[model samples]
Target: MSCLFSPIKLREETLANRIVMSPMCQYMAKEDGFATGWHLVHLASRAVGGVGLVLVEATAVEPRGRISDGDLGLWSDNHIKPLERIVKAVHDLGGKIGIQLAHAGRKSESRAGIPVAPSPIPFDEGYRTPHELSEGEIQEIQERFAEAAQRALRAGFDVIEVHAAHGYLISEFLSPAANKRTDRYGGSTENRARFLRETINAVRSVWPKERPLFVRISASDYTLDCMTLEETLRLLGCLKSEAVDVWDISSGGIVPTGLQPVAIGAYPGYQIPYASRIKRELGLITMAVGLISSPELAEYTLQAGNADLIALGRELLRNPYWPLSAASALGEEIPWPKPYERAK
Candidate 1:
């Protein structure tokens, strides 16, 4: 049997398979960060399409944390029922759903308030220079994360993945290039990891212990003087006591350097090695996310014990039913939704 179709358990949840639908932003929200019909159908379609885990896109913990005005937000109680609808529908249809709680920091393009970051660095050219968050503001941000996780609980989400990757708020703090603070929140690896550690602890406070909490990190910054994989390992070591259940590892985007980290002709499963190393050395469950678009390669990745989960982005966007097609490609039988079983 192909390992890609194999079941895996995390905390109280048992995933139907090893394939995860990685979170991708859908800028379709109507206003005020509410989930609309588009979101319910977009996520539900993937759940029905046979993904073991369907993670909602980067959701802002506060309104100012949104990457755009259209981004989803859980900063208020009113957002719960709309999201709860999607969660219940996914669960009823036989799939698990997770929401990636995020804060865009300097990356926020909402135009409502000045973006805030660990430092005053702007994301890149054409991006606004952000305000440096004061110590009090930092504490508030942590509480906001905790509050967002609490909202997730109320929304009936099965899992919560903290969005610490992709040059967002947490990623800005994690990367040295974006964070140049001389205070306790910067200067050393331990200090730099402080925000993330506190964020995890704060979320874990309100979030139930039995439910798994995942942390997505940009494992490598792919730039000189930025956080290297080694630095990330040291940082993760500091965060180990926080009890992070999984490391959804992705690299780059911590800085806006225009250069490609991989040379021309990068292939599938490019980021597996970084995840495998973390799993081997740090003893953490790691999910490899990159261009892992092929079923054969994804199966091989699991069979080789390179990574615990295979996260796909673009390919899944092209085909919500990619997992079903993949099962057929690998000559494995997985039950399809009753309405679609006739095609199977």
Candidate 2:
């Protein structure tokens, strides 16, 4: 059997294969941040298409944390039922499902209210300067993350991934370029990592230890003043006690377009090296993502131990059934949905 088709267990959750549908924002939620039918169909299709694990998009932990007014949220109890529907649909289809809990912070484009960040810096000239988060407010945000994790557990998700990547709230704290605070939450790398460390601890308080917790991080900020691969390693080392089960590695987005790393899609498997190195050095499981589309490439990555799991974003969007086709291409006999078995 191809490595890609092999099952792997993380905590108590055992995925059918190494194929993961990386969370991609749909931007189709109701203004109140409720999941709509579009989200159910979007995520369920991938499960039906045989994705081993389907991850819901970056869901906002609070109203103002939304990337847009239409982003899904878990801030309120009302949001749970709609998300639970999606979870049930995916589980019934025999696929594991996860949700990426996020806070957009300075990157929030939602017209709800002012954005908040570790500093008052704007993401770019076009964006407004985000209000610097007070120490009290920072604690509140961490509580919000914990509250959201409780909602995720109530919704019955198999995994919960914290979105600390791509210049969002937690990412802002990690990047020196975005965080200019002199407080304990800034200055040294250990200081900057404090927010993330505490945030993960908060989530872990509510999220079950038996279930896995994943953290998505931008391994490199692609700018000298921001995080480098070595700095990222230090940051992860600081988080060692959190017991994060997997590091879903991706890079850049700490700075604006020109200042960030070149577009990740410029080369296939462009971000694999970051994941590979993190796994090798830190001895942590990682999910490699970014422009990894072909079955051959995904299979090679697993066979070579580059990453524990292969996460696909745009490729899954282009073909929800990419996993089904990929199994055929690699000569792995994965099961297809009974309705599609005739065609297979």
Best by lDDT: 2
**lDDT of the candidates, in the order given:** 0.89, 0.93
In model 1, which runs have C-alpha deviations exceeding 4 angstroms?
A: 257-266
The C-alpha stretches of model 2 lying farther than 4 A from their native spots are 261-265
Question: What is candidate 2's lDDT per residue for 170-272, written digit by digit as tens?
Answer: 9999999899999999999999999999999999988998999999999998876578889999999888864699899998887887756444445999999
Taking every candidate in turn, the Cα RMSD to the unseen true structure, in Å, is 1.4, 1.2
* Candidate 1 local lDDT, residue 158: 86
Model 2 residue 60 CA deviation (Å) reads 0.7
Clash numbers, per candidate: 0, 0
| Candidate 1 whole-model C-alpha lDDT, 0 to 1 | 0.89
* Predicted structure 2: lDDT: 0.93
Output the TM-score of candidate 2. Answer: 0.98
